[model samples]
Target: MALASALAIGLLISAPGTSHGAGPRDVAGTRHAAGTHHLASEPGSPRTVSTGWSVPWGLSWLPDGSALLTERDAFKVYTLTRDGTKRQVGEVPNVVTTSGEGGLLSIAVSPSWNADHYVYVMHTAAEGNRIARMTFDGSALADYKVVVDGIRKNTYHNGGRIKFGPDGYLYATTGDARTPDLAQDRTSLNGKILRMTPEGKPAPGNPFHSLVYSYGHRNPQGITWDAQGRLWEGELGDQTYDELNLIEPGKNYGWPRCEGSCSTSGMTDPKRQWPVAEASPSAVAYADGAIYMAALRGERLWRIPVDGASAGTPKAYYAHTYGRLRTVESVPGTKSLWLTTTNADNSGEGEPGSDTVFQIDLT
Candidate 1:
């Protein structure tokens, strides 16, 4: 696929209730000619909600419009109100942040959170990468329990994104931990997408009859379902390409054998591929028939329109305007997306206290 044409437009930068850094500028909606399906060029600026975060990695929304956020290096969780008031919830115990990309990564509030009050987190521990459950009492997180463990961990490629599917099952993406061969080893938990119950058991009807749902991933950090309940993933590749894949049951996404796309039999090709420098894509979210992907190395937001299982050409937005976007999530019951920046980390161009969260309107 060819790169989408760039539109020179202006955006309105806004910061609500806080006077700090600038938000996205040059807000213009992409316009398409009649009956044409193309990437959108209208990219609007987001509103800065909060700042002063240290490599914030995960974001999950509570029932009452509050958000739970995790800081990767700090091993701390915070609750941010809609008005941008942030309060420290609690620190995750025994988290190992020594490794480069290892630390507190992703968070998911249970579908039955109102009743169970359970919040799930994926973090790096002394043994390896693990998923743990903690109880949230509207104030703090307690009763930390390790739900799943033994995922390989390394300085990089500890694929750390977790979310609940529309079917109410928990899904996790794991890296090969720099061991590329592990991506092909289905028996190993690394380099694959795992579907399991909230209790850490394999979800029934999984294609492999094991925890592995799909294998042959390098380091997939983003997973979200489209309106048709089909899963989409954003993957980080080696030096060649970054991929946006449509995930299927028991399928193999060619990793070591193929980076982006190949004619190899039985290996699923990516729906879209971009150069590594253009898209070290991280977390993704679906909203209004399009998948929004946050790019770290690219330092931009990508919006790809999805029709059924196929994706159209992707358009880049906010390119290099913000340093290192880490997560993008759709706000439930609204046409908004919550984006978090990962500038405080080693790979970013931000200062010590330079991470932030922004609210973007897609309407």
Candidate 2:
């Protein structure tokens, strides 16, 4: 067993059914039936939508039901039709695919895409990680413009996940980039959740009076908003724990000082934490009153039931059946979800043409 798994065994035996005082709750505001244990049976099976991708990473749906997908090591973006036909949009300009984890990471369609034809992307460049905008003219991509730059980047821990929130502001997740101190530095954009405008300016009413909306994160990847407009994040821990955090403006999620939960002043505790072997969670999506988290190392999809500000014990699906799940995107106007796998990447099992996109119907 891993160190985290051993630690969790001792902790569970000592505490029995509690989790650092705050545990997931059910719809009736009652304690979860499964208590603090994160293990649960698979809910349902997911249907394959597309396959044969090389490290597919990001996924975003367009207004016309077509979806945009990104390949991390390939540094390429493609549009996928409902029938699974893919057309290469273009390669992001100047993307550097490192041997480690940094590369073309995420894509976010502009809120005004119909009029502006703008699509934003986050990728690793020669200097560092950056967010850029390009015009997608239905068939091709052009008019490349750098929006945000100077975010630190290392071989790993780039934390490259970006999305447009319901509030019409762009939210991006950044990692410590191997520099842990940068997480605590308000002046640095590393290890922060940034809220910005469509024009790349800091969103008004940002908690830090800068681009940072939340700080002190290790390597947060998945970010999504609840029905109540509250932001939640999925974070990877360093050999100790994996966290699901309820993000709040200006809140400091304890990083180097604390891995899971701490008594430190001004540090926010995670709503749920699991052993790293069970959850190296990636992109998350909220649908049907639950948060769906895609796991990479753990090789599963976690379903955490949500009720207002509380979350319920998480259930696992497709554990080890499919390898290295990357991102989970909720389909608009339906109870279905889109998930992508990263088996073709270096860290994964690297099955031949094994990278695939799947559709899961929640109803």
Candidate 3:
């Protein structure tokens, strides 16, 4: 459980698109390593934590172990306690939704929240998508300041997930903004995993001499660090594939050029890949020696085991049982995971406030 260098580079394996227990059959003709396989039983069911939510998008814990949660279209932030009590804290101002995906998206309580009382959020503004900071006194929010901006926005592809890494630096995921070529452009902030200081400046030792930590991502929406401080990401691919990548500084995850696994030189392959039909992944959380990826189109939670740099076969849980999983987050000091549904979102076809949050206890 030692922490690795934040800038260290590593490689992961490739896996096929398979739904282990429920829904549909495994996708054939997808390229993967020989040893990648599936398990038979499904993970246990989750206990409902709360209900009546409308598109809850992000969840991050405060110093006291309670979590701060965000609603995408409402521009509202709420605090959820351990006993299932939910209270509205504040609403992010100047936020605009694309009527599709953009709005108040991700939240991360500053690592030094005890001293700084700072909270950060990624949201869509009039000009573009922004990473902003504000004061959270454990009771209310105030004093907003824009830390990072200029990430282009689109109706559907505005990638938005942010977390403070084990290195104490801020890391964010971004989409290509519907422009495929931008994923390959190192200069563009779109389609990249960015590591930055709390003040929005590029972190030291970044490969590109800029904020970009890794490039060539299509619409990456999930990122988390393992017990060893290795970063993992989940992305939405085009028509063919979705990706679960073991992130490394300076590496390029093939996007427009390669969908899943390809022999193309210089572009890194994913630790696991799934057909777009089986995995439109959103948020990923690391817990109990595995990465739990929340799937949208697949409507399942994928648990992929990890050992150092290698990823094992993915196992699916709660397939089609909880309409459109959106986010999965590890509880700070427990063997539990908090999961959210996106059933109230535009693509879900459910009534507003139909979304819910659940706690999945790992054995």
Q: Per-residue lDDT for 59-161 in model 2, tens only?
A: 8878798899999988889999767899898988889976888999999999888998999999999999999999998889898899899999999889999
What is the per-residue lDDT of model 1 for residues 105-213, given as tens digits with 9 covering 90 to 100? 9999999999999999999999999999999999999999998998999999999999999899999999999999999999999999999999999999999898999
Among residues 3 or more apart in sequence or in different chains, the pairs in candidate 1 whose N, CA or C atoms overlap within 3 Å are 10-26, 10-27, 11-26, 11-27, 29-42, 30-42
Best by TM-score: 3
Residue pairs clashing, model 3: none
Pairing residues by index, what is the TM-score of model 3?
0.91
lDDT of each: 0.83, 0.80, 0.84
RMSD of 1: 6.5
Clashes of each: 6, 0, 0
Better of 1 and 2 by lDDT: 1
Segments of candidate 3 deviating more than 4 angstroms: 1-42
Which 10 residues in a row give candidate 2 its minimum summed lDDT? 6-15
lDDT string for model 3 (1-363, tens) is 211333221111011232246433434344545354333223344567788899999999897978999999999999998678999999999999999999999999999999999999999999989999999998999999999999999998888999999899999999998998898999999999999999999999999899999999999999998877899999999998898899999998998899888889998988788988878999998776677889999988887776778777777776776778898887766667788898899985688898888875554
What is the descending TM-score order? Answer: 3, 1, 2
TM-score to native of every candidate shown? 0.90, 0.88, 0.91
Kindly provide the TM-score of model 1 when superposed on the true structure, using C-alpha atoms: 0.90
